[model samples]
Target: MCSDFEPLGKSSLFTILDACKASTRKSLQGINYFAAEAGEAFDGIRKMIEDKVALHNDSARLIENLKRARFYLKSDYKVHVARSSNIADHCCVYALSDPEKRDFAQDCDHEHNESCAECSNLTRTLNEIERLLEETEEDEELLHRTLKKFRSYREAIEAWKAHLLRSINQDLCRENLLDKLSNDEIYLNLDWAMKFLPIKSREPQSEFFGKRGI
Candidate 1:
């Protein structure tokens, strides 16, 4: 008895093609936006655009592979639904024969398997495109935050440097007082006077005494 399995439908092939077109369009749109906004965060946006472009290229290649597969199925496998209904009628009969072959044949039905595979590919590609787009947006936000932090740090360092300069000048006043003291006066209270003078905290190496500039 001829199997009663249905051949792949034209609708299934068209659906895959449509999905490919949609995926390509979405990726292209994302890439274009990323490129246009490159100046916003040049490195981040450029990387995102490159990722999207790569994904688009991959999807295009997959579509070409599917097209080749379809051609082979139609020409070699005699699986064209429109040209010969025998493929479908045979599948239907086979489905009623041995239970294992019935299940296997059903699983291999081109319409079902091909459509499922195409849909899966489309979903995966769409998700990747969206993720890359989001990364660009997040990177821009990070750059803005970093700039604000840098400006705040710069202002704080300037203020700290000014305070340090004033403290160094105060040491000069102490030096003048020491010069004025007679030998007897200096000897009379040398330990007490030494305690009052501001001593340098180690030798000045860099700004903030070799500590963090901020």
Candidate 2:
């Protein structure tokens, strides 16, 4: 959950980060239109929206690549297993044709078909791919859980930002007490800093900060 977990490399890990950033930025930009003043704040929000759109598009491409990788791995697994089964079946047929020759044929066929170095290597490859797939799946689950927590954090941030902006706008228009306006910006900045800083930390601490912000 390290903000350093910022999307990197060609892996699905990057995809998750891109998606999270995209969602967070888009939400912030949407909220900003209703929450912030014109000029700097509005321009900043517009830039965020543009950046988030790009990230979102990149995430989509990454997801498609992941799907293709998964499909290839699955197809390879199926083909390897099918080939193994067919070879085993052929060995069984040869062994059954002659009772006297059964032992030799079984031993020879098992070594030739099932225990060949090439077959062993292919089996190892399949096992490794399966393990990688499982790890990728687990990573994806963790990413989703992290994203859910992030969404909640974002919602709270938006609400707090909007409330502060409204208070400031009201004060500027002479609708709120000046004394109240005096503390609003300070308290809002404090709240935002508290929420933003710790999210940049590593997991567990990051999650703790996110929940606390909520």
Question: How do the residues 137-157 of candidate 2 rate in per-residue lDDT, one tens digit apiece?
Answer: 446775465345434433443
Candidate closest to the true structure, highest TM-score: 1
lDDT, residue 142, model 2: 57
* lDDT for model 1: 0.38
Per residue, candidate 1 scores C-alpha lDDT tens digits across 63-120 of 4543443343224322222211233322323222356565443343343222233323
TM-score of each: 0.21, 0.19
